[model samples]
Target: MTTKHLNLKFSVKDTDAIRNMAKSGRTAYAIALWFIRQGRPVATDEVLRVCDDMGVKVRKSA
Candidate 1:
């Protein structure tokens, strides 16, 4: 068996926000899995909606 490598880039701010939410007692896995179940995703724009609902503050980046 072989494993493939993939690259994913998230802004420093978004990474920080994810960390903060975890620190604040939100289960990161739950958020991700919930979106997966909904056939949505963790894409920035989509995730931001979840973040906004969870009151997660995100710094914008392009």
Candidate 2:
């Protein structure tokens, strides 16, 4: 089996857009996961901050 990995990188504008989406009721994790599936995983801290700023609660995984 073989695996491929891609470094997730986003510009300031992209981060702003993601934050805006979070403010519009989008789940931070969902946004992060979307990027991840596209081979661009976002930082967990960044996502969590967005969720917090937007007053969204992220359920902890068991």
Candidate 3:
């Protein structure tokens, strides 16, 4: 599958790609958007910072 980036550097985890469309659960996109809404979604590290700051842990792909 091809994902069109929003000019955002951070890459969402493969696992959270689909399940993150909503806010009911924690996912990469959801977490990233949370930062974008805060006016800080330009770099990959920044995106990761948002999730880390929020204590949302992304699972590692095997």
Task: Judging by TM-score against the true structure, name the best candidate.
Answer: 2
Where's the lowest-lDDT run of ten residues in candidate 1? 1-10
Candidate 3 residue pairs in clash (backbone atoms < 3 Å): none
Model 2 over residues 1-62: C-alpha lDDT tens digits? Answer: 11132213555565566667665666666777767887876766667655455455553221
- Return the TM-score for candidate 3, rounded to 2 decimals: 0.31
Instruction: Give a tens-digit lDDT track for model 3, residues 3-59.
Output: 333424444552244234323454454555665776855444544444444455653
Better of 1 and 3 by TM-score: 1
The lDDT-based order of candidates, best leading, equals 2, 1, 3
TM per prediction: 0.37, 0.50, 0.31
Q: Model 2: which residue pairs collide?
A: none
Q: Model 1, 11-61: lDDT tens per residue?
A: 445455565754565555554554466575665454455455445654434
TM-score of 2: 0.50
lDDT measured at residue 58 in model 2 versus the true structure, 0 to 100: 57
Clashing pairs in 1: none
